[model samples]
Target: MKQLPPEYYALLEELQAVDFVLVELTLYLDTHPHDYDAIQQYNQFAQQRGLLKKQIESKFGPLQQYGNSYSGYPWNWDDAPWPWQV
Candidate 1:
């Protein structure tokens, strides 16, 4: 199995944190859109998450894809050596 670089692992963790923040903020905003502070914070994390996603995909692979073969890069998410393997 192949091992991911330290940066990739760190980025993965950061992405997870960003995702959690996004989900929580999304749920909160669903009924409280007037919370400008929350909205701004959500947007900030969302943007960071987007950029991290691209960075991950560029180095590792796409976690999720959009449309039919019309995005992302060439990654080996199908085979062995999952994230925890390293």
Candidate 2:
């Protein structure tokens, strides 16, 4: 695998942390559907995740092999280095 810059790993770590919180909140909400506080927290985390994803894509590239991240030029998604390889 290719070595990625520290910033890339940092952003990925931050996003992973947000995703972990979201998963936990989801599991809690599954049993206590009316937990308003948890619901709000989940929404906040979800928003954070989206913003983080955008940041990562803008700075590095698409996180997935296919999706909205694709755009003009010589197909960036196809050229962007994979996380594991970077």
Candidate 3:
């Protein structure tokens, strides 16, 4: 595989970790609905993920083709490298 820039990998790794935490918290909340602390943690991570996604989109481009993440001129999504390719 081609090597991506270190910052790209770092941002992706952090996003993945935040997403994992959010998923696990969701599962936990499904069983323990009254756990306010866990709910707060989940919300915090969700916010972090959103901010990180925005940063990623700004620096790299849309993470998806059909969503609001698209920006810039000439609709370059088709020309940018895919995540797995880098």
- Cα lDDT tens digits, model 2, 3-86, are 568999899889889989999999999999999999999999999999998999887778875565645465665554566564
Could you tell me which 10 consecutive residues in candidate 1 have the lowest summed lDDT? 65-74
Instruction: Give all candidate RMSDs, comma-separated.
Output: 3.1, 2.2, 2.2
At residue 11, candidate 3 shows an lDDT of 90
List candidate 2 segments past 4 Å from native.
84-86
Instruction: Tell me the whole-model lDDT of each prediction, alpha carbons only.
Output: 0.76, 0.81, 0.82
Evaluate model 2: give its TM-score: 0.81
Q: Write the per-residue lDDT of candidate 3 for residues 1-86, one digit (tens) a residue.
A: 33458999799888889989999999999999999999999999999999998998788777766665775687766754666565
Cα lDDT for residue 62, candidate 2: 81
C-alpha-based local distance difference test score of model 2: 0.81
Off by over 4 Å in 3: 1-3, 84-86
Greater TM-score among 1 and 2 belongs to 2
Best-performing candidate as measured by TM-score: 3
User: Sort by TM-score, best first: what order?
Assistant: 3, 2, 1
